[model samples]
Target: MDAQAWDERYAASELVWSREPNRLVAAELADLPPGTAVDLGAGEGRNAIWLASHGWSATAVDFSQVALDKGARLAEGLDVTWVCADATTWQPPAPVDLVVVAYLQLPAADRRRAVRNAVTMLRPGGTFLLVAHDSTNLTEGTGGPQDPAVLMTAADVVDDLSGLDVEVVRAERVDRAVTTAEAHRGEDRRTARDCLVRVVRR
Candidate 1:
């Protein structure tokens, strides 16, 4: 969806995503000392707010101004700057200690562009982490984008930044449990497959 479409979606709802950070994002980054960070495609600044609460100077970038506005309201006194821009092309004023790309699903070419550009925004030793629905999620997992073109895998993410001076800390498929109505009734279980890529600029 484009910015306007996202704006409608965000404006129509109180909150599109949760108030807390993504589980994998928190688990992978909590160990690192707080620093300047960017949460690219931050839907509602949840992760960015979480980072600020933990002492990181965070920036939340998204194309939808409506989403950013809501995020700003949610982040009233936090150290987070909300910017309305295309994640595929947005550039930070300076290299930061961390760049996080979460669920920014796009076509292959655009996804590659965004991932490559995100890596460039990282200073030496800076971390670049991406979490998204795995390509296999459409066929083998629970809920996610049904379009395969937008879904990606760990290998695809690593390949997107191939030849860059970076060290791959972790790249693998991870499972996220999604509570379903059946589960609430103690009937069935479901999981969403997601690809997680964590790298450090060398």
Candidate 2:
């Protein structure tokens, strides 16, 4: 979906995504010392807010003004720089200690470009975490983008970041339990199957 489509989706709902950080994000970064971080396509700042609370100076970038506005309001007292820009082209002011790109779907080529862009923003030894709906999730798990172009495998992400001495700390199809509220809302009957990849910049 484009900026306008995402804007409409956010406008139609109180919160399009959960208020908490992605489970994979929390788990992977739990051991790392806090530092500068960038959250690409950060919708409503859930992960960005969580990063701030965890001592990371975060920059949250999203194209939708509505999402950025809501994120700024939600992050009223936190230290997060909210930037409204398209993730495909936005560049960080400098390399950061952590770079997060969670569930930001696009065509295969565009996805690779975005991933490369994000990787370029990571400082040496910094962490780059990518989480997305597994390609098999469309037929096996809960609801997510049905477009095959957007869904990907862990190997796909690894391939995209090829030249970067990336060691896949975690690359697999993991089952994440859904909340009761989500289930009751008919969001998805079963847990989500997500592909997670954590790599360290060389």
Candidate 3:
């Protein structure tokens, strides 16, 4: 979907996502010391707000101005900078300690650009973490984009960051609990297949 489509969604709903941080984000990063972070494609700033609340200075970037506006309103005293820009082309002015690319579904070429840019924006010894819908979710798991082209696997992330000077801490498919609301079912809890990648710059 494009920025306009996203804006329409945010405009229609008061909250497009939950207030809590992504499961993989909290699980993998909660233990790390606070530092500067960039939440690429940060829809509604959920992750960015959580990072700021946890002592990290965060910058949230998204193409949808509507989403950024909503996030800014929700992030009243937090240390978060909201930027309305495309993640694939918007380069951060300086390298940050952490860069998070979460659930930004796009075509392979576009996704490759965004992922490469994310790694490029990381400082030396900084970390680049990615959590996204796995391609297999369409058939094997529940609740995610139905299009295969928009979803990716852990190996895709490894290939996207192939030349980067980084240490892969974890890269694999993981399962996340899908609630009834997310699954569009009545009391049927399911698992969402997701790809998680955690890499530290060398």
Candidate 4:
């Protein structure tokens, strides 16, 4: 979806995503010391706000101004900068200690562009983290984009940054549990497959 479409979606809902950070983002980054960070394609600034609350200066970049506005209202006094810009082409004023791209599904070419551009915002020794619906999620997992073109694999993401000077920390398919109506009634919860990539600029 384009920025206008996303704006409508965000405007139609009170919160498109949760107020808390993504599970994997918090789990992997909680140990790192606070620093300047950027959340690319940040939907509602949840992760960026969380980072700011934890003492990190965070910039939340997204194409949808409506989403950014909602996030800004939610973030009231936090140190989170909301930028209405395309994540695939936007550049930070300076390199930061960490860059996060979560659930930013796009076609292959655009995805590659976003992945590569995100890395460029990281300083040497800085972290770059991305999480999205795995390509296999359409058939093997649950609750994600049904379009295959937008889904990606961990290896695909790593390949997107092939010429960059970075060390892969973790690049793998991971599971995210999703609660279903059946699960609420005591059935097994389904899981969604996600590609998680974490690398550090060398």
Best by lDDT: 4
* lDDT (tens digit, per residue) of candidate 2 on 1-202: 7889889988998898888898889987888899999999998989999999999899999999889888888888888999999897899878899999999988899899988888889888988998999999898877789888899998999999888766667778888776444645655446888999888888
- lDDT of each candidate versus the true structure: 0.94, 0.88, 0.93, 0.96
Judge candidate 3 against the unseen true structure and give its global Cα lDDT, from 0 to 1. Answer: 0.93
Q: Give the TM-score (vs. native) of candidate 2.
A: 0.93
lDDT for 124 in candidate 1 is 99
**Candidate 1 regions with alpha-carbon error over 4 angstroms:** 182-188
lDDT (C-alpha) at residue 58 in model 1: 99
State which candidate, 3 or 4, has the greater lDDT: 4
Candidate 3's residue-wise lDDT over 20-59, tens digit each?
A: 8998899899899999999999999999999999999999
Model 2: residues with Cα > 4 Å off, grouped in runs: 179-189
User: What lDDT is reached at residue 158 by model 1?
Assistant: 97
lDDT of 4 by residue, 1-202 (tens): 8889999999998999999999999998999999999999999999999999999999999999999999999999999999999999999999999999999999999999999999999999999999999999999999989999999999999999999999999999999998767634775689999999999999
TM-score of 3: 0.96
Ranking by lDDT: 4, 1, 3, 2
TM-score of each: 0.96, 0.93, 0.96, 0.97
